[model samples]
Target: MTDRTPPAPSLAQLRALIAVADAGGFGEAAAEYGVSQSSLSEAVAKLEALAGRPLLRRTPGGTVPTEAGARVLTHARAAVQAAADALLAAQEENGGLSGTLRVASMRSAATHLLPPALAAFRARHPRVTVALLDSDAGGGGAPAVRSGRADLAVILADEAPDLRLSPLPPDEYLFVAPAARGTHPVTLAELGAAPLILPPHLDSCYRRIRTYLAARGVSLTAVSEVEQDSVILSMVGHGLGVTVMPRLALLPLPPGLVALPLPEPLARPLALAALPHRAGLPVIRAFTQAVLSHLPVPELPAKEPGPLPVPVSAPPLN
Candidate 1:
């Protein structure tokens, strides 16, 4: 004879046996499961046979599990709960919202969007640790998400289509010049005529500024092209040339530079993208909510965002 054991008892049979013990008899268990008492009894019998032990003793003190039955019931309840937890985990995974969330964002988010939200999320969930891959330019975000490097990304508007796109609050772009340039606002046309330190074409703000100027039939002298906002602003502070940037990006302006709104209002759109399953996790939700609450839509002077690190060659123009 083979010395192999019988296949383990099926979960369904274990469940039926537990129900009978709980409900006092097969008749009651059958009523609960909408099956016949005979069927329920057969199910329990199958469970006992697989376990190679008698599970219940009916000695007129109402039906009760024998010692063996009690042990099986203990494991059955645990197994059921474990199975339920696994199912919930699978659902969360399918919805793209739960599990460890990794993020990569362009400079604006790295500097402005993530700090507060990340702090808040940490306070709430000390167990969840976030990996912030600092990417000042938008190019890093797409590969991070697509290659499973990051769960989500807050990239430039131009990079939105490369992954998934979600439009953020509208924000205006302004020209920043040395404070010595004075407080008078300049027309978009005139501003375009000034020597400009611009971001590379891969940057969304760069493309937006270029498009806005082209549409207005204005062309400025392009002096320098930089990859990051801080560097571009630093170049401006150094008397390199004036540059255009979203209002939120101006918070940490150098001492000598003053921000001037363009005569014609222009808005730069920001967006968030993620792999299909990355958006739904609890951490992502909490992080996104915290960011949205902290990053105001209006450029209110009193609600100005915190200072960010900008490469400053000298104090801003004053």
Candidate 2:
């Protein structure tokens, strides 16, 4: 048997190493963990030395785990999770759900859904801090939830997930343009003729919009593609072209634009997702409750099922 000193690896070292690997770079990992790169690097180096083998390899784009590094990372993540579970369990035993509640959401949700709920939630749980982020489009919210950086995510739901997800409330898609343009609703076939501003191909809204139109044998003529709601709304306000956006986005509409409900009645269901292990936490439960209490659901069509316990709120308009 070989005699080797079993190094005591600190949680900090494991976290630094994991963050760098997940973030794909030292700078990003350091920023995420609120540590200087040098400090993070030192911690990672110490971890590698303790492990008795090199665990990571520096690449042009970022750092990647070598074969040995991947093993270390897997175990490190497990250990970190165990430690977190222990801490959360201890907190539960000693106190109530009182800690920072990190939330990641899309911009439209941030603008319309979060404010009132957050305000009410704050009044109820004054000790629990809230951190909300409008993460990148294309559902980058997944990373925030998976990384433990966010306790909960209110986002466009992916059909299949590696995490537990619960549907919040449904939001509708609308073909919005300047109100001065017209009152009559335009069909997808007719609107396919006009130049359009649209979401990027990878965006859930864009993909769903495409699928709906495609199913009806229609397609919008694209003038340009943009990633955020604000840009699309601004372009519509300027009469650059019409764009399809969630009705919730109407809350932040520029002066000249108006949103008309789509005839198709296609509703995108939003969801709250967290690691399955974290689903039972009070913070997650409270956050989910806060979400259910805030989403401004639209009127359901006669044939459709009644809206979920959608909070009574005004139309998705300013």
Scored by lDDT, the top model is: 2
Point out where model 1 deviates above 4 Å.
Answer: 1-99, 162-166, 301-318
Query: Compared with the true structure, what per-residue lDDT tens digits does model 1 show for residues 180-211?
Result: 77766577666767788887776667778888
Per-prediction TM-score to the true structure, in the order listed? 0.58, 0.79
How much is 117 displaced in model 2, in angstroms? 2.2
Task: Put down candidate 2 lDDT per residue, 1-318, tens digits, no spaces.
Answer: 897867699999998889888888789888887889999889999998988888888888678988998888777887887687665655551255676777888777776677777877777777878988767643467777776667787766765378788886677777777768765666776568767788888777888887877888876666588977788888787878888777676665566666665667787888878888887776677777776777665555444322112245533321
Error of 2 at 114 (Å): 1.6
Model 2 is weakest, by summed lDDT over 10 consecutive residues, at 302-311
Q: What is the TM-score of candidate 2?
A: 0.79
Most accurate candidate by TM-score: 2
**Cα lDDT listed for each candidate:** 0.68, 0.74
Clash count (model 2, backbone only): 0
